[model samples]
Target: MILAVGNIKGGVGKTTLAVNLTIALAQQGRDILLVDGDEQRTATTFTELRTEQLGQAGYTAVSLHGAAIRTQVMQLSPKYSDIVIDSGGRDTGSLRAALTVAETLLIPVQPRSFDIWAVDQVAELVKEAREINEGLRAFVILNGADAQGRDNEESAEALSEIEGLEFLPVSIGRRKAFPNAAATGRAVTEQTPKDSKAVEELAALLSAIQ
Candidate 1:
């Protein structure tokens, strides 16, 4: 399965979610390929850090830059059971092309007005991608929200207002562990194995996608 994790706005945890989900899926013994489509290469850097921290021989991160994105993604489909594509913040020709071949498009959004606006554009892009790829499945997920308190009302309302959208029941809360884990090039599950909100949320998100 090819899962494209993306959004129109940056800093809404697209790459974070991508990396963590890929790691979690890999832990489940699935052969995974994490493609860093972002020019910033945040996901690539995280993979490098993970290699060093774990004393692996080489970096596990991969990149599919420039043209030939569709070809690359298609080639990966048979080799790996799960391929997670972490795209850039803004929409791009290359991104649209990749999404066209993706099995599932996971859109991550934060709780804010600007982020909310980006959701519409991202959804439209997903719809366009679906037009080209009939089997493409798109889903919205709330990230960086306070699940324990009422601080997540705006995001919840926005999610509710958007009818006919598949919103994941799992919402990733804003926590220090996420940033700390990203800094060291490790997923939250590897950083904190027990009683971690990031781990639990990611696991739930993966289940929903499955």
Candidate 2:
């Protein structure tokens, strides 16, 4: 499967999710390709750290931006069991190109008014992409959600109203385990002194998408 983690707005944890998901898929013994489609190349950096710290990056990593993302990913798709792309924060050629080839697109949104308002832009993009890639499936997952509040629920409700996005019930809370693990080029599930809640949340998300 070709999956893309993207959003029209930044700070939604797109790279974090892409990197972790790539590692998680590799951990499952699958041949995975991690594509750093974002101009920032954060995913590429994470793979570098993983290689330095662990002596190997569990998955293959590459940097492809703009329309090249579509062409290159299509060429490389047959060699890997799964591919995960960390697209740019905003609507760019990379994101647009990714949408064209990815079978599933996961859009992470924080439980905030600004993030909620930004969904419309994403929906419009999805609408356009579907015209060319009719098989694309877009899902919205809540990220950096507050531990205690109605914000999560409210955001889910708002997202459900959006036509093109399917609101995923699973939410990844604002947990320190995410960054703490990422610092060492690890996923929450692979981190030392594991945070059970964080692991469980990530697992649930993986399952939900499947």
Top candidate on lDDT is 2
As a TM-score, model 1 comes out at 0.91
Inter-residue clash pairs, candidate 1: none
Weakest lDDT window of 10 consecutive positions for candidate 1: 57-66
Candidate 2 similarity to native, TM-score: 0.98
On residues 1-210, what C-alpha lDDT tens digit does candidate 1 reach at each position? 888887778899989898888888888888888889888888888887778788751224577764556788887678887888887777576578778878888888887778877788777777787777888888887888865665477676776676435777678888878888888777788775444666777788889997
**Which ranges in model 2 have alpha carbons more than 4 Å from their true place?**
none
What's the lDDT of the predicted structure labeled candidate 1? 0.78
lDDT of each: 0.78, 0.91
* TM-scores vs. true structure, each candidate: 0.91, 0.98
lDDT of 2 by residue, 151-173 (tens): 99898999999998899888899
